[model samples]
Target: MTKYYFLLFLFLLAGESFAQNNLDSLVQIRGFAIAAPRPDGLPDFIKFVNEELAPRKVNTLILRVDYNYRFESHPELRDSVTLSKKDVRKLVDACKKQGIAIIPQINLLGHQSWAEKTENLLKVYPDFDETPWVKMPAKGEYKWPNPDGLYCKSYCPLHPGVHKVVFELVDEIMEAFEAKAFHAGMDEVFYLGEDKCPRCAGRDKAVLFANEVQKIRDHLAMKNQELWIWGDRLIDGRTTGIGLWAASYNHTYPAIDLIPRDVIICDWQYTRDNQTAVYFAMKGLRVVTCSWNRPEIALQQVDSHVRSRDLSNKELKGRFYGLAHTVWSGPTPFLKGYYANTQDPKDGDKTPWNTFKVMFEKIGKLETGH
Candidate 1:
């Protein structure tokens, strides 16, 4: 009887140790929520914080606020319906109390388009267009998945005066949110080295690409902030199916090798095994997997992040961080309880990020006991 009791104690200790190891592996579970600064949107966005985001053990929010911020530096760049600096401060204080990091996303290197539906950057400065003569399409002129849609304009990275305006805009957004890191939206930059642009023409595409990323990284470094960008642009499209999505247009690989080692890569893969996350991890850059609006995909991404950590390779160890699931489509649902997404295909119409949020919460609670 004494021997039996001794063996049981050993078994219980081993089990607890295993649980700790599993929990320690994941650093954070984040939501990529975009905040619309309108009056109607602010209430829901705040509710998303107090109700959904706080309870779930979701410690980070990579908010893509866009031009919704009221900018003192660039008044023309802000939308007519924008969040006042005070409004953002309230959310920041609220989020701080809940122990969540509010990282603001600003469109930096690419994403300048305005036909019918408008984006503010290039809508205000047309000469900033990378391909000014590509014949900008009227809003809704191109159907979804149209490669012509790939022609969405980008500002010339080589333009002499572009970064002056870009830096001021970034400074305003970062200061307003009191952000620790900045997400420079440098994905799907399709128009590099175009003949229509005088500055970018005949430039080596790879040098041009790495230079743009380094410029942003260096700018953020001055203020002692970290730089983050989507991993799609760094992925090798020919090998990875990620090429099929927004684009593999420039196919910038080996280029990831050129940027600062401290820069975080937000590797978003909606479908496929997200081998890109592993590849980035292997390269010694800190990486996190991002999921789009699907439950099964989010589960697989979390699993992939875990399985990647389980590998024996020393270079692949430790630098791989956490997972962030995106909530792009809206009205953003304000959920009551924190629950992880399951394998059921017909699960009620929650966005992929919501499902992923619950999934992370479930895993995170086991570790932090939150």
Candidate 2:
């Protein structure tokens, strides 16, 4: 009877081990770090990675190399600007040392402007400007605001030549950094089937995205690489309301199965109640929860969101990959200003420097039930 009991216990342990490994393989820890800050008082991106990010078992760093503020229209602007190759190298080296892979994120489809300060890429490739929202008035200036409040000039996804340009840019970035995964910025793609574009007028919105995703996926696959995309646009109508959320929202568009399953879905919600991660995972897609640097309220939200997602999803419990905290330098543009905002004592005294610290402490409590 003791032998029988021992044999049953061994089988149960093996089953648990298999389940744990399966979940761990799917859960990727996504993070956004200041990889290429301007020259003035650049924080050692490497030091931060080594000291902060690595210990958290963060497997992926979504390095923000955005062009809207850093460089516009001319990719060549990267040459004149502040972030250097050496800075990138240091970060990449640190990432390698820490066993974390870098997936460099360049804003490709939209979020293409910091303001009118930089010349628009759409201006150079007018054929590629896919936004039906923006009517090019007779005077040639883009129709301001475009009915929607968000300021975005979308590149036409239908244009074959546009893919060529995008591929070229992707190729350049891939060659420069040698990262295995590339984050194809497909967030908030409002202009799915543009009204004026004859090429896009009659196509299904879901099909349009699927085709586009396939195009990038095929390109990356050829180069022996993979792609990661935002999960907002892929929520299926059957499981959830299709138009339940505003079009601007991450979960606003179609079904998860619309895109290829291989593509990583960055399930993101900056709100305190981060229920989106659970929904995404339930749909049989991999998920990564994302948060941003906000006020003290934001950290409270993150804590709540993390706990909700982690505890609520039992089948996907260990499958709940990890969390991503973004340090956005938008309103707070300067480094000191950003540091102050994230470091504000009210922020649970938890800045980016201390996020991992808090995370582990919470994790320890979760593990210990203390």
For every model shown, what is its TM-score relative to the native structure? 0.84, 0.72
- Candidate 2: the clashing residue pairs are 130-156, 232-250, 234-255, 234-256, 235-254, 235-255, 236-255
Q: lDDT at 331 for candidate 1? A: 31
Model 2: per-residue lDDT, tens digit, 84-164?
556566657777888788887766666554334222456556767675445444334545455544355567677778776
Over 4 Å off, model 2: 1-30, 33-35, 39-43, 68-79, 82-84, 114-120, 132-150, 236-252, 294-319, 330-370
lDDT of 2 at 180: 91
lDDT of 1 by residue, 18-121 (tens): 66665655554455555444655676677777886676656778877778778899899888888898888888898899888888887776777634444787
Residue pairs whose backbone atoms clash in candidate 1: 116-139, 339-358, 340-358, 340-359
Mark the 10 consecutive residues where model 1 has the least summed lDDT. 334-343
Cα lDDT for residue 324, model 2? 62
